[model samples]
Target: MRKSLAVLVSGYALAGLAHAMAPAAPEPDAPRTAPQAYAGLGVGLVDYSGGGSKASPKLFGGYEFTNKLALEAGGIDFKKGYGLYIAVKPTVPLTEKLSVYGKVGVAKSRREILPIAALPAAPLVRKNDTGAYGAFGLQYSITPNTVVTAEYERFGKKKESGAKEDVWTLALKFFF
Candidate 1:
């Protein structure tokens, strides 16, 4: 009786270990979620404060590790100039389909200046500058993988001319 009881207890212990090592099953009724990575393209108007306003185009990509945070990088062509930027975005959800976010980053920009023919010595100017950038935006999810956003962004002033740039953009993003 004692030997039989020991064998039974050992069998139960091995069975418990097997059960603990088994992989968990996924829930079939879980809600759909967004992908971890995405890409976006946008076009809008850039207002160079006290300078002028012109059409601008931008391309960007990002990765979301969690629902509330992401890292992004992009390039923008603003009128006669262009810039490359990288930013961190922190987001807050207001509803199931709407959210707000803020971005802070750094940018490297190249500005082209036309020659001043009226001046005594007419010379073309090209300047490369680097500065901080910030933005705030609202996003609405049209589908699990698509989002639309409207945002306002500000680029820091140029080192030489102290001129700042701002843009208002509408963007569409897709996650894969």
Candidate 2:
């Protein structure tokens, strides 16, 4: 599931890139949308390849360079630790009020497992790693400055030792 999600996101991003870079006939007087900043809070379930699933919260902020392009940075709670990421978001509008987007970037994460109460003799376990991150999501506009989003994000899918993670969320995003 993780591998296939990666492939799908990678393929979509590549295709978007190819289309963006290709020359095209200029449209007549397309209105330029100004760059905007946005922030969001998400609540959802987080699943780990090692640890069990748990409810989690995520916080994110970004600057959209255009209606179709943005740079975003966000953090997610992992109970034992946390994950942070920065990604380039490319979006495709499906309608006047809906869009699909993909995020591709780097994530730095760390997880620490404390000795269990039943195993006081055991040592604490710590894992730190930096890896690729990807996400795919949909957005539906509620007002000019507000939208609701549903997303699935993955972190450190090919890690050598640390836990791999997934987050599924429904969130509210506000633009300023």
Candidate 3:
């Protein structure tokens, strides 16, 4: 009887230890919409790859209308030129801290070209063009409200041999 009592106590202790080591179930319905709307401004090199690079200051704002659809706007250079785009992104959460998305949108560029003094009699020309833009980027969310992203964008526009202007840009972005 003494031996049996000792075995039973040891079994109970071991069972309690097993129960304590089990992982707790995560809470359900914890909210996941924090990455929805993001707004930020970034000052970076705006490379017109084929044209010329400039010190570009841009304002960016995005609203995630749904998990897959978003509308984003960027205004740059004292609003001399602005881009408004609506895109559908395939977003996949790679980890708790990072995500990847790809988007395709249509963009328009409008700019005022100052008349050169050499051609003082030349009329001022304000050029406007419309094109499509596609972007692919990786985003890191340090916190729910802070994010940094690097994107490669291709803006498709072409100018004739003697055409007035050609504009395309690639940039990196940061959002808070």
Candidate 4:
């Protein structure tokens, strides 16, 4: 009876130890959250259709309403002109750190042309135009609040001179 009692106590202790050593069950998935609003500045080289490329600068800001949708506004100096644009950006995430997006928007552009040295009699020309624009880009998140992008954008033809423009840019953005 004494030996049986000792064996039973030892078995109970070992069972309790096993229970304590077991891994806990996995927790349920957490709810998803959208990114916060952000603002950024970008500078890049703009390639003009008519000739050479030039340095371009931009200021932009936006809010992400969801993981896939956002609204943005920006001002850009596109070499020969300057424009203000508002766009809807729809994004598709390929991974936690990478995404592709499309931009569709309208812009108001103002262009100024100075008289050429060969044409002394030519006056300075100023024109204002409004048009639709589109862009597609790949954004790679470098951190929670910073991203880098490579994009191609096209602007509609100028109403006055029937000129169109395109640019390829690499940009860095920081989110607030």
> RMSD to native for every prediction?
10.2, 18.5, 12.1, 12.2
- Candidate 3 structure quality by residue, lDDT tens digits, 90-168: 6667787677788777766565555666998897666676887677777766555566776665444653221222223
Model 1: lowest-lDDT 10 consecutive positions: 26-35
Cα-lDDT of candidate 3:
0.58
Greater lDDT among 1 and 2 belongs to 2
TM-score of candidate 2 against the unseen true structure:
0.74
Which model, 2 or 4, shows the larger lDDT?
A: 2
Per-prediction tally of clashes: 0, 0, 0, 0
Cα lDDT of model 1 by residue, 6-75, tens digit: 9999999999999999987434432234438989999867756356667688899999867688898888
* TM-score of every candidate: 0.73, 0.74, 0.59, 0.72
> Mind giving the per-residue lDDT tens digits that candidate 2 earns over 23-118?
884343332267999999998687655556777888999999998999999998877788999999999988878899999999888877666779
Considering every candidate listed, which one attains the maximal TM-score? Answer: 2
Residue-level lDDT of model 4, residues 1-176, one tens digit each, is 99999999999999999989998643332211556687877875665544556778888888888768889888778666786778999989888788899999987777766567699899878777778978899998887678898887766564433124565667777766
Q: Candidate 3: TM-score?
A: 0.59
**Candidates ranked, most accurate by lDDT first:** 2, 1, 4, 3
The local distance difference test score of model 4 is 0.75
Q: State the displacement of the C-alpha of residue 131, model 2, in Å, after optimal TM-score superposition.
A: 0.5
lDDT of each: 0.78, 0.83, 0.58, 0.75
Segments of candidate 1 deviating more than 4 angstroms? 1-35, 48-51, 158-164
Residue 154 displacement (Å), model 3: 3.1
